[model samples]
Target: MAKNSGRGRKSGGPSSRPTKPLWRRIVRSVFIWGAALGLLGAIFLATAVLFTMRELPSYSALKSSQNGQMIVVRARDGTELVSLGPSYGRWLSYDQIPQVMRDAMVTVEDRRFREHIGVDPIGMLRAVKVRFERGHFREGASTITQQLARNIFLNNSYSWTRKAREAVLALALERKFSKDQILELYLNKVYFGGGAYGIDAASRKFFGHPATGLTTPEAAIIAGLVKAPSNYSPTADMQAAIGRGNVVLGLMAKNGVISQDEADAIDLSQVKVAKEEGQNSVRYFTDWALPQLDLLLPETNEPIEVWTTLDPAMQKAATAAIDNNVPKGTQGALVSLDRDGGVLAMVGGTDYVSSNYNRATNAVRQPGSAWKLFVYMAALEAGYTPSDRVVDEPVTIDGWSPQNSGRSYAGEIDVRTAFAYSKNTIAAQLGNEVGFGTVASMARRFGITTAINTQPAMVLGTSEVRVIDMTRAFAEVSAGGTSVEPYGITKVTTTNGEVLYQHKSVQGQVLVPHYVAAGITDMLQTTVATGTGRAAQIGRPVAGKTGTTSSNKDGWFLGFSSGITTGVWMGRDDAKAVRGLSGGHAPARAFADYMKVAVAKRPVEEFDTKLQLPEWQLEPDDEQLQGDPDDYYYTDENGNLVHPGTGTQYDEQPRYDDGAVGPGPGPGIPQVPDYGQQNGAMPPPAANDDFLNRATGRGTAQDPGLRPGQGTGVVPRPSPSPVRTSGAY
Candidate 1:
């Protein structure tokens, strides 16, 4: 049909015009499609740009509303100690930022920050090539403006659409703000970790100074955190931060931001990280206090201030004392309390960085001889005077007989004397005479919250107890027998100074009888003056008691000086023995050192010296009773001495140094035959006769030579076994 029209040679016929080459047609079609796609892409990009610009805030609003909530902790004196959430310092201007910091940031983050209009094609292409070669995406090519855009508006989710949005926002930011403003915004808005936001906050938090005076290495370190705040933050990983800082220095030198020699001259070690108040030892206090916020304040994420009773200076001294006195590989914890039970200082471990177990409040360990306080209190409550004499001879209660530290004893000692010397035999005798239930009751009344095993061994502090509880008990005695509920937060308020909670220092209800408290205090004073706690003497009218567990697994010194009471514990985390580490030595020394600082500001206040009791004289010497020197004449339920017949009669026990095992259920304390050795001398010790090595603890707390529920002796594990009310303590 078209051939018929060829007679007229139609101008528009495809055959009238020679057909175009196939390749040319293909090229033309491609050009048309590319043009249409380019138009659509342009429109799509403009739409994305508009969408990204929708929710952006003005610079003023951004600055004012960035950090939402923060919990700041302060000392009693209103000194800022630490904060929990995002914390910002004063906003710094572009001129205020150190030039080294600016240079470091630019060289490491974006070399073409000034030349590019928010994004650099060369950098993008180079990053793409590297990523393609590596077969994975890597973080790079983000200009400073792009970073600022992301920090201000976008979250940390990665995607193609996210990249497009970031580029659009970056371009918009560059158009909206000058280069200096963009950089200032970037530095001020970026997260630098450690609860710090902005360069100023980061500088103050890490270096303990303002950003205006940062050193080259310090500046580089701070700037390097922009890529990954937690990774490069000095407080988080100083080594990684340092390495990245070195890389930044090298880059700065190569990019002419700094001279090569200048870069080399800087060493990250010279950059001292400014220590927070109390050298971060207060972190223990904050860790202890933050959880209590829910109980103390109204439920809200709103920022608040916890005005704790923490004595920053005392905290620093306490941590230093532990670090200096605690032997290497062993751990020590200390906590100080005021008369009202305000935690003035708390150190959970020798190094908070290495171990954060919080031994002060959380760890439940054996209190050793320190448990004698409650036994003496029970005796006093039962109408026994401190002057009442008791024989410190080996006594057996229900097949369990614990000896003194060195398997030695001091006989015919008074109550106060026994307490001062931490005589396990006398303590057991008194505990047995008063009824073990009464002794456990007395411990409960005195604030020993942990389970008291109440076995005959419990008389020697075989039960587990926390250091804080022990300190609280002593605090009660220091408060003239008033109850002491351990407290740290004195008041809580909003950042604007509106008080949310105000602690009223109410006089606590009497927890112990007046005579009982006085008696215990008297014994404590005598202990520090002449007994095992003599090492705790701080040149003040301080009173304290010492405690050492079997094989010296745990050593503790709980004391009160001036208006402050402190308890210290030294032990291994594994509950293993530390030879020769007794409460009278390292723990007592730690208590003295910490107390020296804890009570430095307070006036020396002496404990009650007057004691009321019906005094009695000792029985006249009897040669028949002197047959077996190792024999013990225990007091009956009525506080009457029960002498034995056949001249198995008990005499005054021989003296022993403080290393022998005490009288208790503490394992590894060997059982000896009753009445065989001449001159009342003990037979030579058998193997594992040192301490109760055969004693076993429950719940993974095994003694060095002991197992759970096996051989007799003090166990390190806490047990809920019923109190043997009928047995002798």
Candidate 2:
């Protein structure tokens, strides 16, 4: 029993050796296993580092690689118009960079940037701990060097392998270059959104100044963009950018880079963010010129200088004219073409940023009465003079009865007078007489490529046509019947002074007879002087046509001087009619406004008007015509009927009024004498020949001046000769 007590005491009591507790044993095993795994992880990371370093780019390659330089567009005088590329400004050095910018960058991007060789282990561990506590990876611990490594050498793909490669590259970069050199390279290559790369370009683009002139707050704002440039763009969102800048300022103070008092002194209100000038103003012209680039430079990586024909002053004037004249919510486009078809200015729409659909070049709409130029040209080509008389009365063709806008008819008028009033009835009648096919052919001859219909309605300007084509056609007319193909680019050269391409002017074909063109110009002069296009007069002898569609959906005024031919179109894009809008109103007014400024420097030149007209076709004496009744009807030397009442002559009977009643002989004019057997008896109808001769105003077939019923047994006592008006006579 004593031996058993001794053994129990030895087992239960404190002895020389004591068994370890379960918790402590488990802890020891875990520690040992953890240490082993940690060693293995370290070995794996080192091996990865070795492998990645082997595949890394050489330092020389990194130093030589550069972002693409901008392709600068220039004016004819070599003035820079705009830049197109990734980097738009000069490179900035570390010393050129503002100290506040450097501090803000280092504080917000990497606090231990100076202390870390490349990767910050403390930052990484902290990131890992925070991520683990939050149950997911939500924070980044990449040092500035790591970011530089990725940006310069690797793509921004998230993966352990990529991250390991980035770490290796960063480490190699640290050993290869000093911290200042790395930071300089990073600052020079970092993208600051808005197609702006590098601190210099970002500074210039946002503040309109160099990076060396950045204020403390501006530097903070720029540095804050390192994380998300687009979200913190000063031009895009000022409040968000300022808030981010305040955060960066706080970080700078906390990191001992700046004093708290310095940060507190920064008033957010005093931070004047630079306003970026909208680059979309030239978008239309640039878009039109883009296709020419391939022909200009087939293969070039260096910056190429493009000399364009765009006149900035005229462009501004055109834009302002449309903006001021056209009603709100309605769009407008103006295109100015010089004598050689160089596009001096183009405003495709009111706001290019809102809609890039180039109305000037792409949109096709009906030209309304503006299309009458083609119709009248066709008539002239078909042997109808501008002085030819056409009765302006309602008529129907192919079951389509077209009427005048106001339903008021000027019974008989000359073509010139008809066109001046934009008489739709007369135009339709002329189109019918000349044939729709002939009118369409004339339009095609004038450089109109848009499909034209041969229907009677087409004579009233019912077809859709592009504004550019219309302008080109008018340019042809202005060039005295010579065709013009619109072109913009003049020359392109590389930065190394190598001429890539140069424009060669091509002579266009003559599309109209010179005399006919001059006659047309003379007629159009009357349009601007006292006609529908009166509003388009530019204080000089200007000629154009006013076109208002049937429902006033589209308004257009295509005019030209000797120097330039411009076309203005105003309407809604969706084809909705703008109430009270007409070609003679807004479009004509806009044209005048644009031309007033456009021709300020150009010498005033009159149109060529040497076409001869018969003496009888000249403007009638207004005093004698109202008093003398015999001067109303006569024949000119060319056998054309000269009518003083209508201020025109005709080679044939007015076609539409052939069967209508005519006014009897006027006062002091000879009357048809009665020749019936009885003195006052009605007579039977005469033979067809005699009756036809009398009806056509020719002498009766029997005798030269015999009465209508002389031989017949009919006594026509001049049925109370109806009151004769000038229109009827």
Candidate 3:
């Protein structure tokens, strides 16, 4: 009876099995798989969403950095002379970019850039496919927003961990910044050709025009080169660039930016090759003023304009001086600052494009006789008169024999005459008379923060000092004894016009009286009138000094007018000597060329007469100096053992008087204990670590222990880690 209930099944068949409808079996299997998959998907979705929410940095809550934006310095004439960056990069606003250039960039780099939310799924899928097929990392799927996130917030590291971090950051960026704003930053900061970073620099390099003024064809050229700068460089390979330009045009056409007819009609053959030229920007000006920026603008991570005291005319003149007067193959640096410590102009090196090493602010080389200002100031403060007699004679101290390069001897002369003539023997004797420590102290007071060894030999400028420091010291002298810390920025404001930081002049007393500083000025003027600095003389009154280190390794000319102070240095990257060259030869000549062009444009002026010092009576010597309680005595520059309290005795003979003789024992110097001298034996000479911190008087002997920013310890983490938990599992 049960078997008959079913269709025409046999009795054995019905007892053996019961059959279900095909549709029902399919439905059951579908239900089971669907439920399992839905549960798995729900769990994965929840975990991914939660993890992302937890790890992602707050978009609106991201605390602005202390170094939020860069500060750009404009000269008095309204020319952009320099810029200081949070990380050596500049950020521009959306409106600052040309609309056409912006459009072209989007068209060539990402057609769907404006429509996506930081990432493009289609592009991502294609990238994944390409990567799989190539069996390696392939084309990027990151949109402009994603790139902005990676470049601005996350560090570049190729790892799943880093990629996850970038993804989180991309999400945050999309929430924080507007599409136009993100694209503006990306265009402004993207790497293009050579070492040039940013569309602005690339525009100037490839099209010989500013980003704002780029033409359609020129913009196409720049846009095309961005994909693979080295491969499609107009200067490196014109054929490759043309081919790339065609590709960009095709992409633009494909994106409906222009009709195919228009694209085909565009003259690819008319694309002019770009020439590779040295950077004409003011790289030196930026470097020389970096220290002042660190001091005055503690918080600089925001967009702001810095109105500087720079004279564009002076900058051009200084650059010309290096190019026109310096010998071929001679590399150098020059800096100019106002009496208020505002940098006016600078030439960091022969060419900023060829080398990024800034010699004006970073190079530390001996200044030779140029450092005599400090020595003489110490002598004058110690009660020595300019008319006092001193001898230029061969001498030795502490088993070290210093020799004058000129090699001839000059008899006793007045202090003023000795200095005017740059007599090494007289300088050494004066430095000895006053404690070498006194010289170092005087230099520090005037703002030379670099460590000057306390040894007597330092009088000849054995320690290395940067040109920027030298220029600032001279600015103090020009300001009539008030030391103004050199500064590059004036004000920093946010995009919404909130004042983040401002720099008022930093003032301090470095010299005792205007007379002391004036005396030094007058001495420097004499150097220009009839001494080594004669070449630096301008029709308007000027004062300066020339210097050459041993073996002619470094050359320098530093000077100042009533309103401006300048320092110029010339040498090789490896510190190799320039043959037959001295500060007076190329350095002074360069100064002269610059002054000739600069002085004509500036109003003629002299220092404030009100700051003039009153004439004072000269005393023979301090009789109050008492003998050392201990029996310790030391040899002076003349190799004569002197009692601790006894002043150095001057002889009438001088050393190496203007090459009349071969090198002789150098002028006498007092035996001052060397603070930097190694214990037991001399330690290895310190390597120049300018790259570590060339600016920010952060490591001067003033604080045997110092670092940038005030903190207990630990370098602060930059931004925040965007990497998070795996979403795949």
Candidate 4:
């Protein structure tokens, strides 16, 4: 039939049956491919994680190993001076931590720490969203557990592999340790600024106490340091640290760790950071002593304790002296030593935090008039007495004309009077007479290691010297002219009570003859009594000199008593001239300030005057006499020498006069004029008197009209008619 044939044709040809939609088919194919690709990606991620975990350090290995200990320094009396090491301080237990500190840490570092299972997925997602919105990563989403994991067993690296390891390691740590144990390890392993490691050390470094006693605000401040130790350090940046602390407090309040009222009640102004442990105000002294450690201990792996000669009271006094007397923008250094050359106090600069130049031991500067002490020592050794008369008239040495600071010269004056006035011309002539080589040799004997020029100008302190050596040189004079090798460490002991080294008291050899020492001491005493160093009088038998160089670039005062020797230097590091500054102004004041406190506990002892007169003065003969009897010596109403003499009465006592000229000088000798009536060329007596009165705590009130000859009593006659007598000596 036709129908059967049509069916057969239709069956043999393409038949139109119900077909599926293109969209459904496409959807089915995509589903199958996506499932297979996702399975491959998961396998790849699993393989990467397994490889990263293999590189992770063992938990037991990291937990067992401990860092190195500290090297502690102590004062002679057992007061702690400082500690030096990589990881220093005590390790605290979990129960010992303050609740406030825990709250602060949790609030700032991880609010969901208690709820998270090691890694906080929700927090990470939020952080990722924020980073996506910002187009860059600016915030961290590490939970406390993750942080602890990273700190303990992982290095800080920015890679997906590292992140995967951190996450896996955090999970492992969470499973192996309790929450409290994790927190304890984290607190003990964190690094704070200033070489402080762990929360306990950080607490002691910033608060001077243990972590258990931390207040809420203090806890907040410490917690803030976790972000950036140096950037948030209270010692380095207090304002920024406080700002961060306030942020922590805000977070704590938001997290309900503390009430809003409690958070608001915190007074940031009342917060005070403890002095940093290793780098306190005594860093100068410690730095100077550090190099000596090698010579002291030699070899030691155990924690050692060095007993130094540093006096805490004297250090405080020295710091106060510089802080109160020296002006801002100017630098100063002070060094105090015992008569036997033991360092008591050392201040290298105005602020140790600002700079660590160690000006006391490292800075080399000109001594100015202070160097005259060595020159005079040479002169004394060359058979010249302090009472010997030297012409103060204009003189030239090798075509170099030396002039007085005031530009007005005294005609003829004894060595004692000329030295007291810091007469430059007299010093130059004396240096030439004694031969600069002799003076330089004497300086070396006194422990001056700096290069010395043999020029006549060296007598006026043109050569530079270190303050430590200068102080040691003065210490020799204080020790009755014995050479002193300055030493700081008295003993060294290990923490286990084993003695490493004990200092032996080595008596320095007698360098200067007894008579020479006594004569120099007497002249220097006169200098403090009525000379340029009158500003350094400490109400005791103090002897010192005032040094002022050209353009006032450097100023110094090196002085001492029977007990202690001190030297002070004030100047600009750049060598810029300081206007109106003189050694008699600030340096002398600082010396007196420090000495007053240094000797407060010690008994006042008088210098030896048994050999007051040198052998030359005692054995004076007709050959040593050059002037008339009345011209050289005149008796006062009380039987005191009015001009110059070598008797004990003139030894330690300052001569005083009522501005009266006794009689006209001999022929060709200039009559001393009343310096009270002079003008610009005359030095201001009020400046000198005010400094003396303020420094010594004596003398009458400041009087501008007071003349140099009016109060001091030792008057060198001015050249009679201002003659230009220029001739080489």
Number of the top candidate by TM-score?
4
User: Candidate 2 residues 309-375, lDDT tens each?
Assistant: 8888888789888999997789999899999899988888887755657899889999999898998
State the C-alpha lDDT per candidate: 0.77, 0.77, 0.67, 0.77
Name the regions of candidate 3 deviating beyond 4 angstroms.
Answer: 1-73, 80-278, 287-306, 492-502, 601-729
User: Which ranges in model 4 have alpha carbons more than 4 Å from their true place?
Assistant: 1-59, 62-64, 88-279, 610-728
Give candidate 4's TM-score. 0.56
Residues 185-291 of candidate 3 have per-residue lDDT tens digits of 67866767654567777776666666777666667778887778768877656777788888887887888877889878888768654565545637556545544
Residue 47 displacement (Å), model 3: 7.4
Give each model a TM-score: 0.54, 0.54, 0.53, 0.56
Candidate 2 weakest lDDT stretch, 10 residues: 711-720
Report the C-alpha lDDT of model 4 over 332-404, residue by residue, as the tens digit. 9999998777899999998776565789999999998999899888877776655556778878888888888
lDDT score for residue 197 of model 4: 73
Better of 1 and 3 by lDDT: 1
